[model samples]
Target: MIQVDRLTKRYGSFKAVDGITFSVGRGEIVGLLGPNGAGKTTTMRVLTTFLGPTSGRATLAGHDVLDEPLEVRRRVGYLPENVPLYLEMRVREYLLYRAKLKDVPRSRRRAAIHEVITRCRLGDVEDRILGHLSKGFRQRVGLAEAMVHDPDILILDEPTAGLDPIQIREVRALIRELGDRHTILLSTHIMSEVEAVCGRVIIIAKGKIAVDDRLDRLRSESSIVLEARGPADAIRRGLESVPGVEHVVQAKVEGDYAAFEIHTKNGSDLREELAQRVLQNGWPLRQLDIRRTTLEDRFIQAVTRETISAEAEREAV
Candidate 1:
């Protein structure tokens, strides 16, 4: 479990993280998404006790990140975007060393190292030097190091970064399996990874949280795609008149048929009303379906909307 309330971090006048608030429940795998320099790493650093927040408060499993940083660190395992690893050390040796550093008893260190090795799929290369390992294998080694202490929370930043497709899949599967037991907060630029592995997503932009909601619910919050063989203006007017329809943005028209996306209130389904209207008007309905929203769609919408809002605020000021 993790909670951050109005957390703010600044470097002089530049605010890296600005009054962001969110929580991760037990055993939940939440994706933290943002464009470059959006303060994702800054937020994670503050949460992990790697950096103290300039203001606000955060806690890990009820321990204050600032006041009880040692306790928080004990419970949180962090794999930063650029993973810090000892290149000269062997995989097993590196994990073993990290386990000891985390205060794993000498009696348990060996077993803990082995467990993470197997879980991270680093068994074959366990004895190989980390410097000699491939980037994918090295990434796994970094993960193994992170979990060597069996922390309750895992904070992984770009866990699959710079990996091949197959390696990315491997890391994703590993993250999913870990989520069954540990609370995971991962930051990634990859939308498919969030859709595939995360239950909820927190889209951060301009040092603020743009959207936070369940993946399935967000996907359902998409426009209704309608294609009908009728006059474009007439179709648009009919759709706009339908209750629950907010705006009907036109897509394109070919001959007598025109495609339009009907934005509805809270992803409401207006297909029945739309069908009735088309039938009453004797309009030929070619296709009517809800357009599924992807993670990319949500991310772009949030960032773009936030940018516009910020611009308007500046103009008002």
Candidate 2:
């Protein structure tokens, strides 16, 4: 379990994370997504006690991040973007050391290390030097070290940053399996990864929380794509005049037919009306379909909106 209320982190005058609030429930996997420099890594660092927040408060499993940092660390296993690895140490050796650092009991330390090694698929390379391993193997070593202590929560930043497709799929499956037992807050640039393993998504931009919602609900947001052959202006006006249509924007022109994306209100299905309108106007309808909103679409929309707002604020001043 994790709780962050108005969490803010700053470096000099630049605010990295600004007044963002969200929570991850027990056994839930939540994706923290954003563009570059959107404070995703900053937020994770603050939660993991690697960096302190400038203001606001965060608690991990009921332990205050600032006042009870040690307790927080005990409950959180962190795998940063660029994992801090001891290049000379063997995979199992590094995990053994990490287990000790996380205070795994002497009796269970061996068992914990073994479990993580197997779970993270590090068995074959367990005896190999970390520095000599491939990037994918090294990433697995980092994951094993993080899970070596069996912490209640896992804070992973770019867990699959440098892995091949096969390795990425393996890691994604492992994360999904881990979610059954640990509350996970993951940060990554891959939308399909979130869609695959995360039940919820929190999109951050410009140092602020932009969208936080269930993955299914967010993906359920849909719009209509219509392509018709007619005067572009007339087709646009007709679609815009539809009762539930919010607005219509011409996507592109393919010869005589033009594609228009129709954004509707309240996720309404106005496809029938739109088709009739096209027919009434004597325009040949080429395509009319509802396009489900994707995680990437929502991510881009949030970040773009934030960027525009920031620009507007700067211009006003």
Candidate 3:
């Protein structure tokens, strides 16, 4: 339901976002991940029609973001990082105002206000003045205002920033619940939050796309970490004979039992072979599973690899 093709943005002499391209289907949750100053916010603004792209094009649900921006805005809900909140208004009042501005019919404004308040967990404080609410509540209030019009798509830029662990979880649950009915574009540096809610990831770096793939597919394709428990000496000796096992390390454990990880070649599956070896040796196997690397590792690997590759290309010139 979202399409960005060769989108670029520049500020004076600096290129904030350079030729990034990707798309998100209906009901899909796509994550935009990168370090600070990686142009994630720039991309979001362009897609939201808050800012015009220097070049290229984007569309939301068949509406051109540049030529038909009003239509795009009508279908897309955006929660910026700073969450332009009006402190003087009560929670429900502020949402009602935004709902009206989004062109919600007079008949639907009250229902829209109540729906977002309930969906965003602002029920208890719906009558509370926004300025008096906690930082967590204020963030949700921002989210509520963004969704007051009940748009088909939601683009959240760091929606959980400055919130406690409890608030983070609450925000995550809300995002997942929203995704069931709306296409979501989640932008955050918090790997755990992305891990918890996002189905696919689009990593941006140096104003370019790094990786875009499903979470499970990314880990399954790269490196699968295997943790095995058995006789230290025998397991070590036997694993060395197993083809495709590149590196093996005996991990330190509390008890006498030995634990080790088998790092194998890419796209290799060594579980069955290792299992047979453990049975053949009559060793008690404690644990055997292919542990994939965390999203953090994958993110770091993707960004670092791109940086080094860019440097190598420059040096070659």
Give the count of colliding residue pairs in each prediction.
Answer: 0, 0, 1
Poorest 10 consecutive residues by lDDT, candidate 3: 222-231
Winner of 1 and 2 under lDDT? 2
The digit string of per-residue lDDT tens for model 3 on 81-111 reads 8888889899888888888799999999888
Residue pairs with clashing backbones, model 2: none
| Residues 230-266, model 2: lDDT tens digits | 8899899999998999989899998999999999999
Candidate maximizing lDDT: 2
Candidate 1, pairs of clashing residues: none
The sequence of per-residue lDDT tens digits that candidate 1 reaches over residues 56-108 is: 99999999998999999889999998888889988888887788789999999
Q: List the residue pairs that clash in candidate 3.
A: 225-291
Q: Model 1 misses residue 98 by how many Å?
A: 1.3
Angstrom error of the Cα, residue 64, model 3: value is 1.3
TM-score of 1: 0.90
| Model 2 TM | 0.91
> Ten-residue segment with the worst summed lDDT in candidate 1?
305-314
What are the lDDT figures for the candidates, one per model? 0.90, 0.91, 0.86
Please report how far candidate 2 places residue 6 from its true position, in Å.
1.2
Superposed Cα RMSD, model 2: 2.3
